[model samples]
Target: MEESIPTCTAFAGHKKIAAGPVVEVAGKVKRYQDKNPDAQILIFDDSSSQQVELDLRGTVADVLSRIPGNQDPDQEKSGPGRPRLGVVSREIGLLPRHWDWLALQPGGASVTLRKLVEEARKQNRSKDAMRQSQNAAYKFMSAMAGDLPHFEEATRAFFAKNRSLFETLTAGWPKDIRDHALKVGELAFHDDKSANP
Candidate 1:
């Protein structure tokens, strides 16, 4: 997936405390921690739903400055080649036949490889997006709602693409958890009309 500004959500116990850009979320979490020192706080990346740890010591600016990916763009180190174009060189292992085919293409190996990758990404965009959304939703659900009632059935329904059944099974869950799950999982059920028709 293409990199974007990191968005995240923070939960204090079962209630969502804050959400938005990572720095903003971290600031809110820090304030909440100041009020309720004993409260368990979990911050999750909105895109990946993976738990994140933040250094909450010191002032809000201090905390925000400590978060990863919060660096100033001007301070970013430029690598060799075209950094402005966002190109990075990486090694790939391809068989001789594949190399031969790439060599025969109009733009040589790198250009041909980039074109092929772009085509494949375009073709699989919907399916890829759906899978990513499902995975993110599952990660969040497993972390927050694992012990809740109908957890197993809800998971099954989620993966099975039975949106109605999934909603039904999660109806009794905490409002925050249910709402967030649906929000993150929304794209998982997106029907590609062109592909389906």
Candidate 2:
């Protein structure tokens, strides 16, 4: 299993101050806060574009310790069954017919379920990514650029998949906000030939 680090971005007022793994961003934010205590700072998770509050009351190492998943994975004790694979057991319900079908699969129910899930994920990957990007952009825009010019129109163009119009509308926004919006929303405008009209 590959380790995935959580990434975040911090903004001081409308200008982005830091972006990268949460630990790094937290360090930057700590220093920024130390120098400018009165400045407004907002931190957002890169994946969800949701605002995250960090405890900036202590030393950099203390701040990092409070962050979830900051522990060294190697130092953590492993639990039962294939810890290296990062598999967790969970109960799932299925109809009798579904169970019967899965039972007949060569690797049994667990393996068959995993294969089916992986196949579906592969098939839906592009659409999933596009939706996630749109959501992330919308969340960030609504929070940071709500009062910016043409925000409403830009939002409409965004959902309508009108990249050109969205770009034009957001062009007048603060440089950092506009750039971050465009970067996160890039995949939302993917030209998938099979996309519905």
How far is each candidate from the true structure, as Cα RMSD in Å?
3.1, 3.4
Per-residue accuracy of model 2 over 129-185 as CA lDDT, tens digit each: 788888999999999999999999999999998999999998889899999998888
lDDT of 1 at 109: 95
Give the CA lDDT, 0 to 100, for residue 113 in model 1. 86
lDDT agreement with native, every candidate? 0.87, 0.88
- Alpha carbon lDDT at 44, candidate 1: 86
Looking at candidate 1, the ten consecutive residues that score lowest on lDDT are 188-197
Task: Flag regions of model 2 displaced more than 4 Å.
Answer: 1-5, 74-84, 89-93, 193-197
What C-alpha root-mean-square deviation, in Å, does candidate 2 show against the real structure?
3.4
lDDT of 2: 0.88
List of clashing residue pairs for candidate 2: none
Off by more than 4 A, model 1? 1-4, 80-85, 104-106, 194-197
Against the true structure, candidate 1 has what lDDT? 0.87
